[model samples]
Target: MMRRFLAILLAAAVLLPSCLRHRPGDSGEATQQKDTVLPLGFLTDAYQVDSSRVRDGETFSGLMNRLGMGARDAYTLVQRCDSIFDVRRMRAGNDVEAYYSADSSGRRLEYVVYHNDRIRSTVFQCRDSICGWVYSRPVQKVRKIADVTIHNSLWNDMIDAGASPLLIVDLADVYAWTVNFFGLQEGDRFRVVYNQTESDGEVIRIDGIDFALYNSGSFSASAIRFDQGDGGNKYWNEKGESMRKAFLKAPLQFTRISSRFTYHRKHPITGKVRPHTAVDYAAPTGTPVHSIGDGTVTLCGWDGSGGGNRIRIRHMNGYETCYMHLSKYASGIRQGSRVAQGQVIGYVGSTGHSTGPHLDFRVWKDGTPIDPLKMISPPSEPLRSENLDSLGKLYQAYLDTLSAR
Candidate 1:
């Protein structure tokens, strides 16, 4: 299961670009023509542009000197831009663009732009005195739809169908409460309608997913994004039920069960027949382990005998969960810490009484050990009736699209 999950993730990353090629309205034609001219920040057509990535050990002063600015001028420019845009804080591998005056003999610097991220940038302008200001780049959001069939796994199948790898994560999150990803079988499929954000013709991120439909063997599920007029948006089902459950289906993303809770089983290390009270999830060392539900950390330390670095979370209604064999705890994860569902609390490790790196996950109900796999958590409140009609129409429209495909 671990290998299959990883394969799905890896395939998504490898196949996203190809899958996107089939998206509607994504023609290969360039949006900007060769004759079309554009300004570089505050600089006009009279400047020559040079773009490069910040190199290791490169300093602002050194960059300015190489760009034909005198040492005194570089120092003065750095001083003026210190508060607005600290040149010292420039990071390696980020894009930097320098605009120089068109004159061949006296090629003076006009402006310098540093791209902080997809939407934010900092510009340093030179005139009588140098000054800097932060600005935003315009982003475009495009709506797209896809119908994907699961062959091996959802991640791999989506990639094969030319959808974004990030979309896989988002879709999984939407159905986290309703679906058991580990239980997904062959022939399962899903359809999704989502928006993709782009800047300068490059995909920046997935803006949001509007709707989704998942069909697993005999079971089918749907999720629709709706606004409740309370300044928050949530995913709800076709029947106006909230998709969020009290507890997540699993503690970690993309994992498989290595061992199950059983009685009279032979131990791997000791070779002694005993009752195993927990389920073990085999994963790579350092894989993030998340809290199964919202709770308070009651115990956050080592268990000397084979438990290794462990954490016990106490939940509402006499429920408790334990995560063992963690290599290290997440920051702010200590005794008495409050953790939300899906929050990373530790990482997979083989610290004590373990043959390999895996998570020994356990749960207790009313102080009695139970099968974590069989624990069924209740869903959150259903959508209010006042907004049901509008959401129902939206959900039907998405469902129609899925059926058409």
Candidate 2:
């Protein structure tokens, strides 16, 4: 009887193997099989990959020919990329890859991949007939929060709080119209929520700021990002007032007030006690000078009356702004040219009479010289009444988040 039971067990085990054999479409064993594709969508196991960086002055054709491809084949490959990409757009320090056959044929180059940027790449298939196509790698958007108190400079304080340069630039852009970055006090604080784009676990850039709160000892303001379906996104305050004003607080960044507007002031270089109607901002040479508001250029040339390279713009409401002591005028800035707010118009320099590198900025209201620092700029279009309710809730939530942090 024991022998009979052993024989039955052996027979059952042999039949079970046949019954469990994987069918053609069965999910049991086939589910484990996955295609090992590289980031460029090529089979990873099928090729031996070699990575390189595009050297300065390296052309696409030159790079392909250097990798053992014939000149004729390289030319053909370039022609195929006419609509796909511009070969001239390839830049130095960009990543590249050459895929060779793993088995034989002297490791023939079968494909080449060029990474255009952090997320975009172009793949060129070199088998028999060359073909090219552009591919974009999947990017992940990550939300980040930053809260910082200024003990030193804004740049240093934000960097110490693990904020990227790009992120800080975005934050500054949001407050350009309202805050004077040059006048930030030591105890000024900032809190913000923003998004960063990532590929391969590396942060590429700060996408945009969702909300921000800036507080000085005397004043406080909050910026909430809101879209009104007007094809552009804008930031607003809790009362639904637009944060973007008609003019930026200052023309350039990273500067200090060296001189203020006064009627009876002693000139430093000329030793003349005269009316200095303009505000002089001390900055290094070649610092970019931006237009404070949207206006048309009325004058862009060297001034013989002590102000060297000068640019005068006439804005709306009988307002005019002038920038003097510029080393050079920005391209496309000429007489009768229209410039937008924050557009770079010139560079700081010691071009005028008796001064180092500094910007002489002046503002006029109805042909009367006024203090640029004390000039009150009007805000942009406010939020529509229908959108105010939602914006209020969003602002409250963002304010709560900032306070909690």
Candidate 3:
């Protein structure tokens, strides 16, 4: 019985091996199953990305520069948008903003400029090459402006009007040549465009004038600086006419107009009316008197107390001017001495007449005394002809930009 069982087991093992061998070969081809293609869905279609918006007082170029724009891009933008801005003209308080895509490449830009509630300019830039907006800002919420009149000097009025001293200095520079602070008065007014930025806290100042309207008892003059191309900024009239008349009204800062030029003028000391041929300027002793125009001194002498000391000049225009009642003559100033307009020739004193210190001023034409106030002096030349075109263009451009803003 044991032998028969063993024989059966051996036969079964042999049969099992033959069956396994015939079943399959162990090749690696079973790993080749096909991969199913799944379609991709964009996340943008389901979700929007958050972005930042710019506010008023934000600069466009500054923000654009902070981005990755190269020099070429900036140059192109300025060139294409020259009518709006040159990239460098952006002010710190302008309204501007930028909209950037999630990836930060595509962008939309909007900008606006305002002077109080008055709109100066508006613009927009976008990936599609055009941009603009209805620039809205609550301007009426705050701000108060007033025209503060300044006379005799700019410093005090500017301070009283709550102007920055820095602005006062700037305003003085504009009217430096024409507005003599020494001769200012209590009636001069200044128009200043300023914002009450924070009530008593701070203010933003802009466009200030030293002599908006100067009423010097003898004459009324106002000066405004204007660009004339290569001639740069020169003072002119409100109608663009040059304020630089033939000559300034007075050579010295005289407080009062003394004796007028008259054929039969009386001598104050003599108590006898003589032919007073000049105007007297009453000022402190030793005050300097200037030559009225470019000329050579023809006389410098004393004539007792009635005339005191006097100096006469000969101008190329055949015109003559006389200065009298001088305390002393300027060094190097004598007969035949060449002098320019506003050059000091002498000082104020009670030398000639019985009155206090004063300057007796006179003008002559064809050797005849005339009203100095009525004399029309020639103006300094304007910009050279070569620069007129450039000046005109710059003026127009400035006006356009100024108007836009």
- Global lDDT scores for all candidate models: 0.79, 0.83, 0.54
Per-candidate alpha-carbon RMSD to the true structure: 11.4, 11.0, 28.5
Tens digits of per-residue lDDT for model 2 on 1-405? 776665444433322110122112246534532222234434545678899999999988889987768889988877766777788898989989998875554777887888888767777877665777666655678998998889998888988988766777888789988888877888999998999988666779899999999999878988999999897548999989999999999998868999999999988977889999999999999999999999999999989998999999999999999999999999989999999999999999999694699999999999999999888999888899999999989988887876686
| Cα-based lDDT at residue 52, candidate 3 | 39
Query: Candidate 3: where is the Cα deviation over 4 Å?
Result: 1-222, 227-233, 238-241, 262-266, 384-405
C-alpha positional error of residue 183 in candidate 3 after TM-score superposition, expressed in Å: 9.3
Q: Highest lDDT among the candidates is held by which one?
A: 2
- Report model 2's TM-score to 2 decimal places: 0.74
lDDT for model 1? 0.79
lDDT of 1 by residue, 74-182 (tens): 7887786676667768888989888777554776677777787767777766545466666654567888887888788777888798887778778879988888777
Residues 69-129, model 3: lDDT tens digits: 4445555555665653445555555443233334366542222222212333333333333
Highest TM-score against the true fold, candidate? 2
Name the 10 consecutive residues with the lowest summed lDDT in model 1. Answer: 16-25
Stretches of candidate 2 exceeding 4 Å from the true structure: 1-58, 63-70, 80-84, 92-113, 123-137, 231-233, 253-275, 281-288, 354-357
Ranking by TM-score: 2, 1, 3
